[model samples]
Target chain A: MRRLRHYARLLAVQMRTSLTLAVQYRFDFFLEGALALFWLAITLIPLLVVYSRRESVAGWSFPEALVVVGWFSVLKSVLDGGVTPSLNFVVEGVRKGTLDFVLLKPADAQFLVSTARFEPWRILDFLGSIAVLVYAFHRLGHAPRAGDLMVGLALFGVALILLYSLWILVVSVSFRVVKVDNLSYLFISIFDAGRWPIDVFKGALRLIFTVVFPLALMTTYPAQALLGKLTSAHALLAGTGGLAFAAIARFVWKRALRAYTSASS
Target chain B: MIRARKLCKTYRVHRRPPGLLEALRSVVRRRYEEVRALCDVSFDIAPGERVGFLGPNGAGKTTALKILSGLLYPTSGSVTVGDFVPQDRRTEFLHMITLVMGQKQQLLWDLPPAETFAMNRALFDLPRDEADATQKELVDLLEIGPLIGKPTRQLSLGERMKCELVAALLHRPRVLFLDEPTIGLDVSMQARVRDFIRRYNESTGATVLLTSHYMEDVAALCPRVIVIDKGHLVYDGDLRTLARRIRPEKRITMHFSSLPAPGELDRLGNCVARSELQATLAVPAAQVTEAVRAALGRLPISDISVEDPPLEEIMQEFLGGQPANGGVRSA
Candidate 1:
């Protein structure tokens, strides 16, 4: 319980630092807010184009696909606001040797580095995603049942863990290959595929999305849970898979730290 | 509080010639060379001792400090700070030590340093009151009260370093690994930092192992120093004893009431520097008293004083004479 409290306090302090930094440049805050809306609008275009000719693509209807896009936007916001900034700080820290400070602290170095920074303005991206999810559900003419909502929220948690674990794997590679900014760009591009429902991907791509990169687990499963179409068994699999990814990420992170020859001071 | 035995750190560096064809060819196959950063280096420091690590650039001083602080693991051998092995980096072990590198900073660039202090308080899990008190004490000591409120980017290099010191020390580390803590600072700023370090050690009984390119920093703050050259530990002992061993001559300066005769100054000792009103001589340690007496008696002298030769000269001569494989000696 004390350890939990300690971590909670650490997270709070990190968030406060991010907030302070976010407000420091008022112009940046406003500009990023505008960009968030712009990106949300851009995200909806392909969905509109595909839905215009056909009533449905694969098995998912337009509103159902919108649900996937909503989740994708939500994850993107978390990636941008919570994960990318912190991990980018880690990469820069590793290059500059400032990661020494993170390592020297008594707390868990991974936790510290993973929460080193945040783009609080990305909360605008998150709110925009909520609006998308709301409009999609409204278009469908019914809200999810409470039980489905609970499952959806739980799956959302699993999705976030998986998303963060994937990023951690990317960051772990950075310890060995110091310059991995392009690797992160590749990751963002791959994540763009998550905007479509899992059914739209078939054969080898479906298998890859389901198991290898797990974009389906990150977006499709939670959307399915909200639509009351997912099974308890699939939910169990998602939970276990998220935990497994986290475990692997932790192992890789530890091994990478052992390999770390901090950049020369 | 700190012990390193036969610490050896080797780095596998990817090497390639500088050419586009070579780069493209190297993509298919790469060459790697093992560079020894530290080899068979050993040292120990008792609690509350201020030991300076002195060496030229790329002399493995920083490498040794990094191993001790647990930022890097030695390729071979063992190191411990306090009761714990550093590479293990146990929470308890990490809580007990801080490494401050002058070339890098831990401060949040866009936020005030007070925010970092708060963040550290949470990260180190210090009680709120205790952390606040420690921050207050350090801020006052560094005289950075007004500056801490400003964004770190707005602060000068010296100011930022002062804040860095406060951040590193706020956890009240038992051992400090300071690498060039006063680097790139003006002379006065350097002296102030050195003074702060000495006082902090005195007050807290913290063990300090510092590496600095500045000889004066080592001279003023460290009673004992470990000198390394070419990845070899050449000497480890009292700073003064090392100085005396390397350059035994004492420097004597005299201000003349009247101009000394042309060769009168040279007769006392080796005249290293001379001007119209004053002259400086390097006299052997054994003959310093005799030389002083001779100068006073034979030459028109207003004032004269004897002091050891400057540390820079001693270090230059010391490192200059050391072979790559010079054996280590401790006084």
Candidate 2:
């Protein structure tokens, strides 16, 4: 518990510093906001076109699909806002030997690396996603029950854990591989597949996302919970998958740290 | 309170030639070469002792320091610092020690140094007043009071390094591992850092293990020195003793009132350098007095001084004489 408090305090420091840094570069924030909105529009344009042609695809209605896309947007915003910047820190830390300083600290290395930065401007995407979610709810003309809201929040938390775990797993490869310029691109490409419903994928590809890659848990399961379509077993499965991915991430991080010879020597 | 028995750290590095075909081939069949970073290195540091870890580049000095500070795990060995194994990196152990690398910094680059200090205060769970007091003391010592407010990237390297010291030392750890702490600093800045480190050690009674390519830093701060070359320990003990052991000749330099004949100076000792009216001779420690007298009597000497050979030369000779695989000294 004390360790948790220490990590929390360190994370708070990171958040505060990142906020100040973002504020200093206000122009960059505006640029990032514009970019994020443009990307969101690009993602939604196809959905709008598809819905115009067909009422629904893969059992999900057009408005319901908007909720899925919005929820994904929110999750992606959180990730781009926090984990992306932190991964950059990891990459630079590895290159410059600053990770040695982190390893020397008394705190857990994983916590330090994960919560080391935040990009406040990326929250624009979250706001945009919330706006879409509200509009989609109004168009559907249905209010989620109290139980559904609770399940949605819980599933959202699970999705966050899964996303964070996958990111750490990807970035931790920097310990063994010095050059990680393309690693994040590869990760985002895999994640882009999650923008659609997992059911749309079939056979080995579906199995890959569902069981092996696990991007399905990051988007589809959470959106399913929020739309009141997730069964108790599915919720349990998502939670279990989150826990397993987190454990694997921790294991991989430990192994990577052990393998870290540092850049100086 | 630091001890290591046969501590060894080796790294397996992937090797590939620089070519498109080699890059493709490496993707298919990657080859690795094992480099011994630290081989059977063993040393004991008593509480409050400040020892200079000395070596040429890639001499295992930084490697040993990294292992002792828990930054890297040793491949095989028994190592303990203040009753905790370093590789375990226990909280108490980490809290008790600090490592400062001049090439790398712990400060948040985009934030002010004061922010990092505050962050460390919370991370270390230091009492507010105590942490503040330590910070103030270090800030005053480093004379970085005003510089702390500026973003780290905006500060000069020396200023940033001073702030880095404050961040690392705010917890008042009992053990400090400093690698090239004075590197890239101006002469005066280096001297200031050396003085600050000495004063900190004196005040806190902290044990310091320092590695630096700058011999002046070692000469100023450390009484005992450990010399390593190519992952092996070649010499260990008193700095003066090591210098005398390796380079027994004292350098005698004289400024003559008039030009002296070459053979006249050669009679005094082995002429190391000679100019129109000045000459320098390398005389064995036992013969330094006789050599000086002979030069004074035979030559029109206006001024003369005798001193031990430069530390750099002593180190070069020490490293050059070491046998291959003369692995790190074991206690």
Candidate 3:
């Protein structure tokens, strides 16, 4: 119980530090706000162009696919605001040997590095994504059932775990390679595909998105849960899959730490 | 509180030649070379001991400190700190130790140092009152009370280092592994840091293992030192004893009221430095009394003093004369 309190306080302090940093330069807050709105517009343009060509690309209608794009925007906010900044700190830390301070702390080094930085202004993007979700539901002429909302929330958590785990796996590679900016760019490029519904892709691409990289689990499955189109069995599989990815990421992270030869002082 | 038994660390470094053609050709296959950073070196430090780790560049001093602080594992052998294996990095072990590297900083670059201190308090799980008191004490000791509220990016290098020390010590760990803690600081700042470290050690009874490029830092703070050369443990003992053993001669410096007669300065001892106003001579330890007597009688001296050779020269001769595989010595 005491350890739990310690970790909670630790998270709060880390967030506060990041918040203090975020507020230090007032111009950055406004700049980030502008960029967030610009990216949201850019994200919707492709969906608009695709839906304009026909009534639907796959089984998903224009409004239904908007739900997937909503979830994508939400996930992107979490990734950009929380995950990517911290993981990028790790990469820079590895190259500069500043990760020594993280390792010397009494807390788990993984947790410490993962919570090192954040961009609080991403809350604007998050609110915009929620507006998109609400508009999609309004266009459907019905509110989601309470049960569907519960499942959707749970699956949203699962999606976050999957996304964070994949990033962790990418960061673990930094211990050996030391410079992984291109690899990180590659991951970001792949993430761009998550903005589309999973069914739009055929055959091997679908299989890869569903299992290997798990973009389907990250965006499409959660959107399906919200629309009341997902079954319990699929939800169960998503839960188990999320846990498995987390387990694999945890294992790789530990092994990579053991193999870490800190950049020479 | 610290024990290392035949600790060895080796790294397999990737090797690549220069030129775009060589880089393209190396894409097909790469070469690696095993570089031994530490080799069968061992030492035990008692609690509250301030020990200097002396070595030239690439002499494995930082590697040894890293291993002791649990940042790196040895390729072979074992180390225990405060009754726990360092490599295991258990909560208790980490809670009892802290490592600071001068070239790198742990403070948040965009935030004030107070935020970093608060973050450490949470990370170390310290009691609120206790942490506050410790922070207050350290801030006063380092005279950084005014600087902590400013953003770290705005602070000068010396001020940032002082704040870094406060953050590292806020946990009040039992062991400290400091690597070049005063690098790039001006002479006054260096002396202030040294003074703070000595007082901290004396007050807290913590074991400190320090490595620095400045011999004056070592001489002022560490009575005992461990010397490594080419990844070999060359000497470990009292600082004065090591200097005496390495260069067993006294340096006599005399200020002249008038120029000495030709060959007069050489008659007393081997002349080392001679200028128009002053000359220094190296005298054998056994004949120091006779040389001084002869100098006093032979030369017109305005001032005279005798001292051991400078620590820098002693270190140069010690490391320069050591064989590649020199045996370890401890006293």
Candidate 4:
């Protein structure tokens, strides 16, 4: 509990530092906000062209697809905004040898590296995603009940944690493979698969997305809860899976710290 | 406050020689080389002691420092800073120590150094008042009053180095591992940084282990030095002793009103350098009195001063052309 408080305080200060930095690139701040919308358009335009002729893909209606897009946008924006900057910190810090400073600090090194630099203005992307999600529900002519929305929020929280954990696991590989800074591209590309419904894939590919890579859980699970299509057993299973992935990420990070072999030695 | 016992660090580095073929072949069949960065290197620094860790480039001084600072785990040995094992990196252990690497900075690049200070204050868990006071004191000492508010990217290298020192010292760390803290600074800035380090040590009684290629920095601040060459601890003793051991002769520099004959200084001692108004002669340790007396008595010298040969000269002789003894003296 004491350690938790210490981390909380550390994160508060990090947030302030990040805000100060974000203020420096005021023009870039607006550009990121604009870029978020541009990203959503580019992602949805192709699907719109497909929906013009066909009503749905694999039983997921176009409006339901919008729900998936909503969840996708939220997760992507949050990842690109708050957590992506920090994850890049890990990659850049590892490449630049600057991480030696982070490791020397009293706080948890992983947390410090992730939160050490950011553009908090990207929170605008998060807000925009909420508006998109609401509009999509309006188009579907159905709004989730308060209790179901709460459950969706909880599931979304787990999914967000799971995404961060996965990124941490990827970034942790930097200790052994210092040149793997570009591995973040792999993360985003795989995460792109989450833009579609998991039910569309079949056999081995379906199994991979739902379980191995776990991209579907990052969006589909949360979308299901909002649609009131989620079962208690499936929700519990997804929550357990998220926890297990988080544990693996933590373990990987610990191993990476042991293998750090900081630069300039 | 810091101790290392037979600490060894061996890195398995992937190797590929120049050429596209090697690069392309490496994709399928990579080569690995085991390089011993630190081999049986052992040293102990008592509380409040300032020791200069010296070595030629890639001589394991930095590897040893990383091991001591909890940044790198030694392959097969133990390291402890204060009361905790360094590799364990316990919060108490981390809070009690700091490592400043001159080549890399801790300050947020786009943010003002003040932000980093604020972040460090919380990270180190110092109370607000105490943290602010320490920050003020360090800023004043370094005379970095105006630089703190500006983006760190805009600051000059010298200015950035000063701010870096402030950030590193804000925690009032008990053990400081400084790696090339004064690198690339001007002579005056170098002197100022050296003075600041000395003052900080004096006031807080923090144990400092510093490594710098600038011998002047080590000579001015550290009384003791530990030198490693090719991952071997060749000398660990008083700074003066290392200088005396390697080059015991004193240099006598005289400024003449007029140029002296070329051979005139040869008789007094080995002429290290000669010019119109100034000449430096390296005289044997025992013959310093005789040489000064003879020069004063015979030569038309205007002013003369005697001093030890520069530390760089001693280091050059000690670690000069010979290939590093990859595995020389065993500690």
Instruction: Indicate which candidate wins on TM-score.
Output: 3
Task: Give one digit per residue, the lDDT tens place, for model 4 in B1-331.
Answer: 7778998999998999999999999999999999999899888889999999888788888888888888888889888788899878788888888888888888878878888888888888888999899999999999999989998999999999999998988888888889989877888898999999999999999999998868878888999999898888988899898789889899999988776766778899899997878889999899999999998877779999999997776776788754322212111
Angstrom error of the Cα, residue A208, model 1: value is 1.8
What docking grade does candidate 3 earn? Answer: high
Question: CA lDDT of B259 in candidate 1?
Answer: 88
Residue B32 miss distance in model 2 (angstroms): 0.9
- The predicted structure with the larger DockQ, 2 or 3, is 3
Q: Rank the candidates by DockQ, best first.
A: 3, 1, 4, 2
State the lDDT of candidate 2 residue by residue for B166-277, as single tens digits. 9999999999999888777888899899999999999889999988768888888999998777777667789999888888889999998888865787778888888888
The interface root-mean-square deviation of each model, in the order shown, is 0.8, 1.6, 0.9, 1.4
Q: Per-residue CA lDDT of candidate 3, range A108-158, in tens?
A: 888988898888988888889999999999988888889999999999999
lDDT (Cα) of model 4:
0.84
Better of 2 and 4 by DockQ: 4
Candidate 2 Cα errors over 4 Å, as ranges:
A1-4, B18-20, B321-331
Model 2 earns a TM-score of: 0.95
Estimate candidate 2's alpha-carbon lDDT, on a 0 to 1 scale: 0.84
| CA-only RMSD, every prediction | 3.2, 3.4, 3.0, 3.3
Q: Extract clashing residue pairs from model 1.
A: none
Candidate 3, overall lDDT?
0.90
DockQ measured for candidate 2: 0.70
- Residues A122-241 of candidate 2 have per-residue lDDT tens digits of 887888888888888889898677888898899888888888998888877998887797998888788888878888788999989987778778788877887888899988999999
Q: Model 4, stretches more than 4 Å misplaced?
A: B258-264, B320-331
